[model samples]
Target: MARLAYVIKFVADMDRAVAFYSETFGFPVRMRTPFWSEVDAGETTLALHPASDANPAGSCQLGFNLDDLRAFYEKGAVTFSVPPREQHGTLLARMIDCEGAEVSLSG
Candidate 1:
């Protein structure tokens, strides 16, 4: 059987990216270094790698399930690409992370 491991995101700024995910989504930092970092995202880990020419920021899209999408969005933590709205009978929203990656949130 195959199981998921890590979802890597190349970030322009390591500190900013770390702060964004940790503070906004409350994902605890598993490890941190100048070149790499990881956040414990439930079953899988979210890895933050320093961005370079070959691996640029905003190249990944991630989705998360929140208890209250509206309340989360209203907190003004990150800039929203799409505000919370009903789509196919589900609440969905999109927000841009510190590294410019598009992240989807649902409740």
Candidate 2:
């Protein structure tokens, strides 16, 4: 079976994107460079790549499971596209990343 490795997210600013994920999600930066970087996202690595015209920033959506959705949202680390709300008995929220990607969060 083929194992999944990295989920690439195109970013306009590598440093900003890396910092956002590291600070907001508390993910550790495994690798860092101007053109490419990687964050250890538990089972998989989230790769950051420089965006081009064809692959613009904010072209991807990422989902994360949080222990405290409200607390995470309250931190104000990133801008929220949608605030936390109950969905079918679970809490869900959407936040905009540094690159404007809408990240889904659930607790």
Candidate 3:
């Protein structure tokens, strides 16, 4: 079977995007440049690309399997769409990413 490798999200500002993921999720920066950056998101790498006419922003919805959803919310780096709540027998929190993409944190 093929395995997942990475997910790329286009952002308007590379620095801000890098800061958001790095600080919010504590994903270490694997590589950084003005046009692109990559983070080590454990099993798969999360990449940030510069937004253009072809690659627009807010193009992906990512869900992170987290151990501490409430603690992440308390960081206040992301705009939580909803507080931690039960969904399908698991704790979940929805939020808008730095680039306005929807993301979920589940525990």
Where in model 3 is the C-alpha error above 4 Å?
61-107
Which stretch of 10 consecutive residues in model 1 shows the poorest summed lDDT? 1-10
**TM-scores of the models, in the given order?**
0.55, 0.54, 0.54
Per-model CA lDDT versus the true structure:
0.82, 0.82, 0.79
Estimate, for each residue in 1-107, the C-alpha lDDT of model 3 and write its tens digit. Answer: 12345677889999999999999999999999997799999998898988887558856546577767778778887798888899869887778877776665676
Estimate, for each residue in 1-107, the C-alpha lDDT of model 2 and write its tens digit: 12344467989999999999999999999999998899999997898989988569966546677777898889898899899999869887878878766676778
The better-scoring model by lDDT among 2 and 3 is 2
What residue runs in model 1 are displaced by over 4 Å at the alpha carbon? Answer: 61-107
Q: Candidate 3 local accuracy as lDDT?
A: 0.79
Q: Candidate 2 has what TM-score? A: 0.54
Deviation from native of the Cα of residue 33 in model 2, angstroms: 0.3
